[model samples]
Target: MASDSSADVVIVGTGVVGCLVAERALDAGLSVLMLEAGPRVDRWRIVENYRNLPPSMRLFHWDAPYPPKPWAPHLETRVAKESEQYLQLEGPNARAYLQGYVRYAGGATWHWAGICWRLTPEDMRLKSLYGVGRDWPFGHDVLEPYYTAAEYAIGVCGPSDPALQWPPNAERSKPYPMGPIPFGPGETRLTEAAARIGMMNLPAPQARNSGVSYHGRPPCCGNNNCFPVCPIAAKYDAATALPKIEAKGGKILANAVVYRVETGEKNAVEAVHYFDPNKVSHRVTAKLFVIACNGIETPKLLLLSKDDRNSNGVANSSDQVGRNMMDQPKLFAEVELAEPLWTGVGPVQSSSILNTTQGEFRNRYAGAMFRMENFARSPLGSAAALKKGLVGKALDTEIRRLSACTARLTVEHEPLPLPINRLTLSSKTDWLGINKPNIYYDVSDYVRRSAKEYTVPRLQQLASELGATSFQLSPEFLNSDHIMGGCIMGSEAATAVVDADCRAHDHQNLFLPGGGAMPSGTASNSTLTMAALALKAADAITAQLKHG
Candidate 1:
């Protein structure tokens, strides 16, 4: 029962990147097998877990994300254990990094907040444009086709605005698979103010489907809890396409947590070792190996697999498997609008004030675009925002009002990279016995300066224009939950983890297809980039298999 299973390609982890790569491999005529660390999620059975709370209580802290069912406990354990490894904050008052991703068959996408923002062309071309970070070997133009393929695969919905794309971002070939989310209360007020102030209120791009069938997937029921678990198939999770893979002679086995990649005589990956649900050891072998675990797990898995051949880690001969962590700073401020803002609606607000459109994110000096998170607030966020943004007695009174008419400004922006801020393996181990991932990230001088000199003033002005009674700015740099890099992509083996195509530089067959490939995605949701990157990797592997 613990014998090795063979396939043309053995993909580790069944998250977004793994699932898409498996699909591409299957379509390319390769025998693929997806090895997962969690069990399969059943739609009909899982629906019973949703109590469906009232909209007001939506964002308050619940029972620590404990699943209502048996499977929920399993997921909780995995996430909690992993969170400890990657969720450490560098300073006090820094937002607790939210690394609460699940390991179930769908991985974290099943419970992901359905926001989808593309890393602008400038994000990929930071070095060439801003003269800051290293230049990506492949620019947005190179990944354009793959972006289209991946968007189609996931059923994305949004309005296409090629003109909206900042330099260094890939241009859109087609419109969003579905229409954009309608404007909500906060957005309406913000939009009105932005127009008055000569700013554009750009529509937010999302992974949620507005039509009946987006790439053959169902539309959302507006359940509102797009994070943690989505009952209906309205959202585009990578596991959305698992059925087709199974039908195409592909097999996905779960609870097989891959801790390390085993190498053969010639340093070719011989097998992958994982623990079953029963905690029994099992090994699976393949002609080639693909590493698609998310940012943290991907690098941790690599460090754990290090042998005498690599003192650093597997595919880490370049000593860059876990470096260059570049997640954006979460900018926040809240304002008590003098007028009613009316925010009560289903996933109503996700657009932003297009400061970049008026040349805010660009000055031929330093920049990255960011939008206000109007509809993305949780109860905790609202309470905290009120307390911080509002002063003393006014804070208590404003928070208690809970009026639909209110305004809060939260922005996620690209941050500068400091080599010290990275993911390294520590001597500590989790309950699972794998070495814990050590995340050492502090806000760079670039971001701190930008927040003070650039972001804060604009936010204060925007709020004032929106007729705010008061406004407050955060003193500390905030981190959006988007985790990326540590295992970055580049052409040089000595500098990065994988090449432009996302294949491991040291290993011919190993590939990393997720945010880990992105050295600097600025302040955008990484899901779309993850999809686009996977498609690019899939194409390269197909060419290799067919030729050699």
Candidate 2:
């Protein structure tokens, strides 16, 4: 292997977690090198791609705008070929695990909605409080300061009023960097309805500038194009950090797929091997290695790097590297209200009913976070009306009515980490001859019971509150794309892959921080938690390099 480069810290993946870690390492004066598996493209190009997409593809196919590179393939669910898919999914709830993330330089943040939700203290102690799911190694207090660091690092904007905060009165080290964005008409109506029902529709803390420039990026202009690509650099995608990271003396190699993790004495990670677009291999040695390749890809890479010293793959001494796959199991309700709600006027998602996220009922089943999907319904309304063969003024009237009246209600349930839900290297290989990831997933009875007995009724009640003339609930569970727990963390090395600081139990220098290391999938989005873990891991890496 050609060992042509080296660094103080080598991070695999260029997602928010990796980027955050890279920034922190550079701030500590450490030489950092990041390897991204996918091609990097300009933000304007992605915006143009969305504008040119077919109306059908542009509506909900978030990954439609950025075409995947052959060597760094991600699942293309809209594609006709099942045989060529990179993720081979199986089990009864396989479709629910069909994630919407991409293998691009910025990772899924390129198309994320920028929702940043922190887990309640009770959320990390599921096994102790709820008698289900694994408890995190540390308490929420230990993670609290890191959460604050992550918020400031990502430039999060949120409500100043504690009443509007999720887990009202939850302790915070510092206030959000900016105040919350104003709600659209639909969100305003829903917030009032939620208050009537004894619930709180809190503005979601988001990683975007409010009305002024933050962290050298422009504020959101309410273009309602957060997904696919933010036309302006308003949202905090890791792609935007690439230039700043480079400016800070951090090196990032795009389209360099790290396939094998090479380990040495005392089971420490010594180097990682990657393949260029042309299939030529290169080796990069570093004092420390951090893998922030989301949930699926992180575990997939670990399971693929099997060696004689660690036959089950590095950090898989307990056979837990690729187990406990999770995502927030989602169910949707499409409701047509009697009054015009006028959604889609701002960001795609701005608020959610977080009160449902915690309760004593969690002992029996999972808790959930409910939200009104704020994406504009106009495209869907027009498509449906067109299919009805309507034209002229009649068509226009129906389109306007349906667009203004319809709203998409969503419920995402917290998931228990089950050993049965796992990802393994498949016989199927990609263009570079690396085994594709095969996953077997089941939302499990925890999430299912929550949806069937608890969340579904709540959705119906919210629909009634909206004065819905008609409503339809989806029959099957959907993927919220908040992936977590493939490299489950805990105090015990027997059952977990990573420790309290997100360092691999078996490999001292290998840090796996992100959704994959989370022990519990809290009902809200997991990106903030992942970012917090990354920051915490970065601290650990800095201490290790300085002291060890």
Candidate achieving the largest lDDT:
2
What tens digits encode model 2's per-residue C-alpha lDDT throughout 424-483?
999989999999899898998888889889999999999999899988999888888988
lDDT of 1 by residue, 224-259 (tens): 556545567778776677887787777888767888
Tally clashes: model 2: 0
Model 2 spans > 4 angstroms off: 1-4, 80-84
Q: Clash number for model 1? A: 13
Best by TM-score: 2
Report the Cα lDDT for residue 452, model 1: 67
TM-scores for the candidates: 0.86, 0.98
